[model samples]
Target chain A: MLIFEPHIHMFSRITDDYERLALAGVRGVLEPAFWLGQNRTSVGTFVDYFETLIGWERHRAQQFGIHHFCTMGLNPREANDDRVNKDVLAILPRYCEKDSCVGVGEIGLDDQTKTEEKFMAEQLELAKRHDLPVLVHTPHRDKKKGFERCIAIVKEQNFPMQKLLLDHGNEETIKITRDLGCWSGFSIYPNTKMDPARMVAIVLEYGVERFVINSAADWGVSDPMMVPRTVVKLEQAGVPRSKIEQLVWKNPIGFFAQSGRISEQMLQQPARANLRETFDGNSVLRGQDPDRV
Target chain B: MSRMHEQLATLLGPAAAGADAEFAKVLADRSHLPVVFPGLPRRLGRNHLGGGRTRVGDATIDLDAFRPCDLAAADLLIRCEASDDELFDLYQHGDIEERTMLLRALHVLPVGPITVRMFGEAQRTNMLVHVEAALCDGDLFARTVGQPGFEPDVANRVLLKLAFLDLPLARCLFAERHANPGLSTMLQDLATEREAAGRAVWRDTWRMIGLAPTAGSAARLVGGLEHGDDGVRAAAAEGLLALGRKDLFAFAEERLPREPRADIRAILQRCLA
Candidate 1:
């Protein structure tokens, strides 16, 4: 039951959530750079956030036995802030080249604002220049429209559609994305996004080719266990175990491996976890005896 | 003559003589060339024509056996030396495949106001591949938006057409640059009309509601908070939160207890937070 959670914001989650994800069979996670609930006011804040995603967050995930990978971008919501966006864009080229950074993403539309689109286009070019895969975040509101807009932009860039992952899709957008020759991503959030039952139905309808299911768990009430939970639902619904494995594990690896960073062997090899491991002066354990555990 | 031969002659014009010589040399040793008709999907049945063999001038070409890379090489040779007018002319009268290839080669073309005009014309047809090539490939649309003569109505039409066709906005060249009040209002009207007709509006329709934040739009967002679909309600809550509408605070507070989903509740909490 090894799993790969394609989209999650572990920076906002508690340390315990990582353990829970690992216990539930999530062997790897790719946390896309996204907006914190409050808008960031400075480029320095974005820089710090990007650093943490590749640095501290990667270390943090390792302690829970999960191999962490991330995609770098100025999130669509924050891209609207002209003040910080320019600086963020300026720094993106450097960060996107990081070893642990898999691709340029969660970059797409939020309000579909001019600034957001401008940054998205630039980031898409950045991804092209780097020859990396893109993890696109479709707007949560007008999702169908957002997905359409996202695909149009990806095509306009002449970026390889096969290398693109259109994230946060619903039933309505799946068929279109699949038809367009891009990978379709479904985030099984507890409430706002697709539910587990709905995900099972989508797999049944769409037949799981280049289809990926993720948690996209962030600061909100999103469940980190959404992937594993959906797996159980799919199994109960009579989906073959092989198909389930493709959606949960293989498909994501295939998509991210386009970045030339991830490999099957890397995902298969277990990352050694030391509960006593500390990032900077921070530890996953606080006052709890590591030896006892 | 083979379609490829004719297309090459049109693309090369005076240069066709030298290119034909190169094509002949390449044809003699076909191992290095790519498959002429790449394994396109069965769904693209129309593209599966001209297979097996064909005649071009004195050459007896094996159309089915050409390398895909050779076609790419031919396109590159033709486009590398072509003028703006020549490229545009070819695009204007080219077949679907040629037009698609020309659009893909837009980055190499000497694009200008005339090229932009051509793009607008192609966009009007709403052909998926042409629309994609015009809007997706180069900065032509972005440049067009920045032109002094650029019309908002035209840009609005492009955006609306994208929604109508269900094309991904991610690739629309001017989508970010042209996210103006006019477009937002148009989207709102479309969403409203669709909802009234009991049709599902594009999800991006809520983005306009969030962006403009008018009293009417706010009211719509508030209405969305109570909508039957959890996704709609959550999206509405997000819009309301982004708007920072203090007036909607009490309304959101009242709805919190009755909110069945924790994700929606989390969004409502953000509105107050």
Candidate 2:
């Protein structure tokens, strides 16, 4: 049962999460460029961060035999931060062409503000120019309205729904998005918003078509193993293994493949790893001998 | 609705009756083309559509994975009052099943350079479902084989892929109809490449080799009659039959008793029939 953790943030996570994910059958992961707890005061921070996602974090995950891909974008929270939003948007197009960057996302309403909306739309245009899919981070507050507003903005832009994946959804949002051509995403959490048990119920009811689940595991309190955990729950509940596989693997791969990069064949084998490899004179192994580590 | 649309609805029979309200509501407005397109499979049920062939674009396709309800719904999509550009955008934005529906419905859309290009772009996908949707159980390749806008010759590339996947080349509606010297050469090359790589060759390569026999490939076809693998021998004999060569008939007749497989023996019998 191969899994592609479609939306996990590994930059903030320790190396153990990568090993655990590999052991749990996560063959690949998509880390959407997102808020790093404390908002960065400058564009250079975002630049270094984006570089890390494609550079070191990717190298780190590959060491554990997990393919790491990331989306390049201005998070909706940062979208409201006028200090770096414009600069982040400027640099996104170039990073977007990076070999591992798959989409323009973790970009959508955060505060549900007009400013957030402005940058979200600009980044959406950036995605359009590059022709990459988007992973929209819908707000947790006033959650239902946030999903609605996100859909409204997408529909208003006349964005291609097939390339849009509105994430952080629940039972209510499924009804709203099921009819839309866009891919619907649910970020499974250890508790609160959505958990494994709830996800199984949704699978039993809604069926897994154009659906994806993620951990959205970031700097905050979240479980990185939500995708794998949800898989176990789905199986226990007797959802067909094929359907569960689709939610975890195929749906996300199919969605992101629209980028005209990455494909099922491309990920069939994990990326080769050489532990001694370094990025900009830095290695994740911290002075340990390459072969010994 | 077009005559074909009416035909699909009639085929659905009772299922169409249950789905009419949803269909009627969505079909009333073509503005819902993108959004309404994805919901078709769910709203119209994905029950395996068992039956004869259905035509799409300029070619006929077996409804291998397409549901009757989905096709009836897909036909509605083809009838959407959108322009070709709008339809093409939908194609670009569609998910796997949606794209498959759009590809299968290609005939009804406006045919021109862009239509030819849409078919070409789809072949680039590495997903077999997308590949199968574009090529298998269909004659979609025949119309675009040498069109002006289509470039890099995806048609032959797709045929090579069909061989690589070991999907029956016979399933391709017009492989023999469009078998040119170039395709024959590429296939023979593929056979060589696979043999050198110690991989199993697509047995159906013999069919095309027989259809457009070059001296080298035709010799290989004659050799196929004595090959160990039953399927390969069967395909080789099938390919030989296409040459209408009498010299090949005696060779097949001599090998008839040694052929143990019923299918290969059947091909051998066809030679002397």
lDDT of each: 0.72, 0.77
Candidate 1 off by > 4 Å:
B1-273
Q: Estimate each model's TM-score.
A: 0.52, 0.57
Q: Number of the top candidate by TM-score?
A: 2
* C-alpha RMSD over true interface residues, each candidate: 23.0, 14.3
lDDT string for model 1 (A72-165, tens) is 9988998898779888887776567556778998899989877777888999998988788999989988888887888788878888889899
Give the per-residue lDDT digits (tens) of candidate 2, residues A22-65.
Answer: 88999999999999887899999987887778667877888888
The residue ranges of model 2 lying beyond 4 angstroms of the native Cα positions read: A1-19, A25-215, A219-293, B14-31, B54-59, B107-114, B143-154
**Model 2, range B117-222, lDDT digits (tens) per residue?**
6666655555455566666666766666677765435567767778866778767677677776777888889889989999898888888878877657768888
Query: What TM-score does chain A reach in every model?
Result: 0.97, 0.97
What is the C-alpha local distance difference test score of candidate 1?
0.72
